[model samples]
Target chain A: MYDGIVQDLIDELGRLPGVGPKSAQRIAFHIIQTESFDVDRLATILQTVRERVRFCIICGNIGEEERCAICRDPRRVPTAICVVEEAKDVVAIERTREYRGLYHVLGGALNPMQGIGPDQLRVAQLMTRLQDPTVEEVIIATDPNVEGEATATYLIRSLLPLGVRVSRLASGLPVGGDLEFADEMTLGRAFEGRRTVER
Target chain B: MYDGIVQDLIDELGRLPGVGPKSAQRIAFHIIQTESFDVDRLATILQTVRERVRFCIICGNIGEEERCAICRDPRRVPTAICVVEEAKDVVAIERTREYRGLYHVLGGALNPMQGIGPDQLRVAQLMTRLQDPTVEEVIIATDPNVEGEATATYLIRSLLPLGVRVSRLASGLPVGGDLEFADEMTLGRAFEGRRTVER
Candidate 1:
């Protein structure tokens, strides 16, 4: 047990994903020991983000305005839209600098056990966006896990009838990882997606 | 790279102690996805703590007013004071429900490499507190590691001249711990601190 304020902080931190009770305690204690200015800055930013930031009306990505930057950028390819499970996935894909298209954040993947389904996601809005005459392709960039795979499959089936070219990101062994340590599914995918080497 | 605001949030989270860039990224994403009400609650509490909490002038623990609850409580023995390095240490000691004395938070332990000396600590304030006529005993509850041990030794040397009784927390094997698995120092401490059982 800890002091009331410290316990409150730990409880709030523990509610975060991947943060256990021990981690929450450690962080709470660290915050208590840190300078008040630093803690105030963090608190200010936390409040500012919640107050000034919101999901883009066009795509579910976070932004200060109604639409995300990519959605407003004329240079980005409006013909193709990459769909992801969360706003973070959009950032992850952007880091590659390979896509020149817009994004549609589904908020979360379909997890029946968690009671999250297609109705709970922004799938209907995505369908509405696909109705634009300029749109041609939809890239499903959901995570390669079971839930992600299920969501992608469901989206592909639904998008096929709309006459849009639907695709999923390839799955394989990670770069810089040893082939010997690769799991069977990843190694198999790497073999299946093998490309010809240029001399 | 993420949106500027998202990046700012990640950077702020990364500044927290023990939170690496990867962990910060994870936490930032988790925060973004969390329910708006939960995020708002965290923001509110963070602001409340920063605005309302202040250090107790007497014991240095966080509180709303001049003195912390522990220091203000008349039930606690004001005649004895336990010295510790940080406010978190005071909370840790209180959880045991063993000692019933007031506390003196020294802010940090003595570390020569880091250039932290007695001058940087609250040792002077502790001595001032000891000058009170009713004070009879001082408990050196600094940590057991190198810096803590050094601090305890320093406190013992400094406090002995004041004619006040000084005691260190007993060192021994932890309750419910295996004797064979205990480290040599712990096992030796347990043997040295062996007590007669009332059979």
Candidate 2:
């Protein structure tokens, strides 16, 4: 809808993960109109990230070095490893400040319908990490959806023979949410997992 | 929420026009995971756009040359110039294939509340363009909102002295839209601008 170079810019912006056509147009125009916007700096950052960033060899999480920050940190618990579906999941868990263990990104969960199975994920790397006798437990923090549950179940089966404790993250009504608006599955989980209140 | 370089990438992405924190995180993860996505090409396009592209000297639209594609096209009707609020509006009108003429981007609408006045836009350039005796008409295609209306009114007043025919794009119920769902202002305009049917 524009000259070659302008159209090229829009097309490249549209190729990003979530930018739709209208949004891409808006952003392209924004870049064109805003005189103070430093497009060259953004370009340099993109180039640098592509050139320097790499996945951690120990886990699948992103890092500029050989291993992820959590994996390199001495304070992170070596005995406990939380398995998550993506690197973004590691960020989300980190925001909670509750967990102090290392992470292993599975890239994605097992979705047989989508042709993603245990072999497609970083499951083998996880199993190898578990080979150490010092590691006492593996926490499956995959999503509560069908694919995530399937992946967690498969991991449990694989880890049973290794004699390490395996646990799944809890699924229930979210905090600050009312019971009336909770979905059926969440309401049921809330009931099944109810704990005694201490006075 | 991530390692140093990954966090820096997210921060830069978040500074873009419409990307929020959550969207920034999502795009960062997508860039990291999709090995096939050509980040280098995107970076190159961005750099090229910054270094090579500039606004058309004649119309204020983005262009690789001194004049935009429309301004350079020999076949475009020179007499009819479509006045729009931004470069994005040029793209929207071009998609319709209805306006076969030149364009004059005002850069922004008049919003006195925000301290934007005629001097802020390319209004002076628009008036200077009308000095050419061959130009016969100026079509005001600014937005339908209050700020757009104010800008159009100001342009109409400014162009009256030049004796060139000043027109406005019709505003009413949109094509394929239900009359019942039309807003009161649009429904009122639709009745006010009712045209006689030809037999």
Candidate 3:
């Protein structure tokens, strides 16, 4: 029911993971109401990023250059690499401010039902990278979901023969959530990873 | 923790109404993953709409030219006009096959707390439009909220002396809503609007 350009915008917005038709319409109206200069700047940045940004050859993170900033940073621990399923995960981990290691994006997690296998990921590339004597530890930071766990299991099995230290992110009850409201998996993990109180 | 361009994109996306920082980050990542051609097209359209779209002088609806499509259409009934709070409301009414009348978008509803008054709206323009002898009826289709009710009341009072028929959209139980679970206001409306059944 919208004009041609507006409809195109709504259609494109609806293609996003969580945005629905109503939300697409709302966003389109918002964009239409915004000032020309502001909208134009957004458009310019979108186009610019599309033209300049590409996956980092070393770690698969998004970057305008051949190497991502994390890959090139000299202060980052070269001996330790954190493996994740996607580039977005790298950003998530970076926000925590705890990890100073490098990253290796696997492109996607293994899902045999959807035909995504080990070959589809950068597993071989990761194995080759680990062959370097400077690399010491590999931390698997995939999502705590089924596909993520399966991918981590596959990685651990493949990497064990290489003699590198392998680790996975600890699972437990999230802080601030009520125990009664916690899901079975989380509660089970909390039980498994329980710690003794020293104080 | 993100690169400067990615942060810029996230900030810009966050400026849109209803889009939080987390949603903005997700949208930015989705945009980054999209093909260059698709991203360029969306960016180009955003710029094009910003540069070309303008408010119709007579009706206040968005248009590329001086007048909106509805204002230019000769077949629409000139004797009756549907007044709404926003341009999106006009689109919503047009989707139904019911109304063949013209439209008058009021920019926004009356709200004293928000500093919006009749002067802030297109009430003066609406009055001018009604001055034409061809106009006979004005349908107030504002939202079913406090601000909309106040605007409708104000319009009815103003238009009574002009010798034009004024009507408000009926408020009652929604089509898909359960009568037993409906709120007091909606249930009260349903009772007030009760009609004799033809048994």
CA-lDDT, candidates in order: 0.74, 0.77, 0.76
Which 10 consecutive positions of candidate 1 chain A have the poorest summed lDDT?
A190-199
Can you write out model 3's per-residue Cα lDDT over A11-126, one digit (the tens) per residue? Answer: 88787656888778778878887554387788888877777778999998888789999999999999989888888778766655567889999988899999999999999889
| TM-scores, all models, native as reference | 0.79, 0.86, 0.85
Candidate 1 per-residue lDDT, tens place, A22-124, comes to 6786677677665653766676677677777789999988888888887888999889888888886676566555678899999888999999999999999
What tens digits encode model 1's per-residue C-alpha lDDT throughout B112-185?
A: 99999999999999999988978887777676677888887888889888888877655664544222234545
DockQ-based ranking: 2, 3, 1
Clashes of each: 0, 0, 0
lDDT of 1 at B10: 91
Best by DockQ: 2
Model 2 over residues A10-114: C-alpha lDDT tens digits? 998898879987778778777776778888777777777778888899989888899988899999989988888888777766755667888899989898888
Model 2 chain A lowest lDDT segment of ten: A190-199
Q: With candidate 2 superimposed using the best TM-score fit, by how many Å does residue A121's alpha carbon deviate from the native?
A: 1.0
lDDT tens digits, residue span B77-153, model 3: 99888888888777766654457788898988899999999999999999999889999778777766677778878
Native-to-model Cα distance after best TM-score fit, residue A173 in candidate 1, in Å: 5.4
Kindly indicate the candidate among 2 and 3 with the higher TM-score. 2
What C-alpha RMSD separates each model from the true structure?
6.7, 6.3, 6.6
- Model 3, residue B178: distance off in Å is 19
